[model samples]
Target: MAKMRDRRVAPSSERRKNPFAAATATRADKTGDSASDRKLVTSFVLLCIVVIPAVSVLLYYVKNAPRASHTISLAHQRGLIKTDVTYQEILTVISENASQLHRHYTYPVLAYITPWNSKGYEMAKRFNTKFTHLSPVWYDLKSQGTSLVLEGRHNADMGWISELRMTGESLVLPRVVLEAFPRELLRNKKLRDKAIDLILTECKEMEYDGIVLESWSRWAAYGILHDPDMRKMALEFIKQLGYALHSVTSVRNNKQHLQLVYVIGPPYSEKLQVHDFGPQDLQSVGDAVDGFSLMTYDFSGPNNPGPNAPLQWIRLTLQLLLGSPSSRVQSVGWKIFVGINFYGNDFILSEGEGEGRAITGREYLNLLEKHRPEFQWEKNSGEHFFLYSDDNHAKHAVFYPSLMSVSMRLEEARSWGTGISIWEIGQGLDYFFDLL
Candidate 1:
């Protein structure tokens, strides 16, 4: 039995020592090694083709993406964003801390308020007399046949006006638009006197400080300025109105002189043109009016989209209107209030799209939150703008007045020793008043 067992064990040993068997074993081992090596090569290739490239792409995105620290998310925390409560809080803080920011400018600030937006009412009440004049867009002077009618009295708020006056004694001038310019109203002497009397009676009866006349553009549109005789009549009408306003004493206070602020349009070009209101017109009516509110904004529109008011363009317009440093009219700078736009323009980069839609600060904030696009500061325009795509994949460009833009404009106006007339207070950020 031992011999039989040994014989079996000897076969096993012989099998282990057999060259053919060992070669077969080596072939099997080589086959296994080749399989493992193939797997390793395949994995490395996959890493190069998929995993590595994926990781590289992820790294690239991570590196290139806008950091949260630099985005509106962070800006919101810094009180750059607005809320009903945050608005008041931010204004309080600004009033306390940055009140002196505009001290470099000693000129008066004229802020416009509109009935369409309630924020303007709140802003006027809060800031009080930070504005020398508060013009409420409440009235329209229109012609109803032979008679002149001063409408929009329904929008007036006497309680609000009383409160605003008590706060800081800001002049409450209601903006009156010339909705209709009848030839008879300008040509007929009795009708002209009737118009002036109507304006004066309204001011005295309503206890209003004065009126902001916005008829130049309407007159221009009617081609009144084109005709030299009509232009002279129009200018004479303004002078008569101005003198009449200044001559009257306020019903509220006998000491106060009712002011007449004339709204003028920008030339919109470097060259001298027969515009709605030009330097010659200013020279004609400069002494009659308390201040000339130059509409320096709307430098661009949908048909020709660009900066709302380019800094360089504004400078040139000023030079053209007020004359260069060498020939600047004395004391005219004080009377000339440079217009600053608190609103922005949203323009579609397409033809026949009408004009740019006006946007407010809150709307702009909503857009920033939604798109989070890179806001670009155009040095040439001294404005902040951003590009976005809508659901239709149509590109839109927004040119809004940023804090920096306003500051540069304020500085520019200050250099000319001019006051600032904000288009409307409700359309801008609360902090914008910091640079008032």
Candidate 2:
């Protein structure tokens, strides 16, 4: 994020007069007043008369709208309006209140748009230019016989992409997860070439600006990273994919080189083992890729039931990836896009409630209205929490993002001179756009 200049609003001078309250000069004599002058003065006066009153009326209604619940009833009774709009308005108001925390950052914001979260499509269009890259969770690489194929192409919204581009020039990079990685696919040259060709062909056909490739987590889960040969092959495959994407310039996108963003998993533990991608991996593939989308959230889960992502833990993860001054990875910080989670977790502290689930902005608002629990801030984690109970009397804990927590996280990412990445915009509140 860039450092913003400090601005101070100058106080109005005592001599300054209100344009509306100022007295109008009397009309000149017919002989003295030219036709053009008369016409100009009349137009100016008319404009003032119309605009001033309209603005005043708007301000008055706005100032009293929050306290005037009876207006809705009165309008409904007179058959002039419906409560649905009023309910929506109330929900918006509630959302705004929950979005009290606001901070401004000028970093490369890469946001993900999921098909499941319908709201995210509109959110992407609404905040079009705020993001540098929009990775719609659309495509996944799956095996069809011995050859690889790109699935989920049917889910792509071409109209929405065009609409989003009309607003801003954010690169439309659909996320492609490696779902069918054969055991020896990375080591096999022909199979690897086939996968790259498939990705390139799909991207070219769709006229996409680029793609966000996610495979590290899958590789780790499959224990591929545990094998030195396989890990090296995996990095080589990424480098080759990056080479293929970067070598071509899209004719549809004003002759811009196709971007390749590699998604990397965060350091699960402080020990910094080889099972996960570390600084060495970053250095190896740094030049091949445009940027690294670091999955930094999910510090705690249902098993532990703590903060979604603690501030201190995030710092440690970054430290591991970026390294210390003596062993710092050259130019790694600028290329890193730190992940930020807009949603929170609702953990079940006791039995009968079932497994914990992720909480959305709307769900968080509903809980606030239902429980009205007092919020407590965890200084160490830099998050806000509240406790509630269901009819069964089973306790639950919610660790949602608060104004201070979001502000601190943004600033922390800014301090590292790295970009910000939202897991998915749909799960976040509308007001969160204020920060971007």
Q: Return the TM-score for each candidate structure.
A: 0.75, 0.76
Q: Which residue pairs clash in candidate 1?
A: none
Error of 2 at 55 (Å): 57
lDDT of 2 by residue, 109-216 (tens): 899888877888988887786788899988888877777778988999999998987778788999998877647688678889888898888888888988999887
Q: After superposition, how far is residue 425 of candidate 2 from its true place, in Å?
A: 0.7
Model 1 spans with C-alpha error above 4 angstroms: 1-104, 326-328, 351-355
lDDT of 2: 0.67
- Report the number of the highest-TM-score candidate: 2
Against the unseen true structure, what C-alpha lDDT does each candidate score? 0.66, 0.67
Q: Name the regions of candidate 2 deviating beyond 4 angstroms.
A: 1-103, 325-328, 351-354
For 1-436, candidate 1 gives per-residue lDDT tens digits of 0110011111111112111100100011111135544443233222111011223223222222111221122223455432122223433444453332222335778888878788889988877746889998888888887688889889999999889777686788988887666477789998889888988999988989999988877676666667888889899999999999989998777997899998887663335656446667778888789898877776665555556776765666676676654443644657878989898877665434434577887887777667665565555456766666668855566777776678778777766667889888988876676556
Quality of model 1 by C-alpha lDDT: 0.66
* Candidate that would win on lDDT: 2
TM-score of 2: 0.76
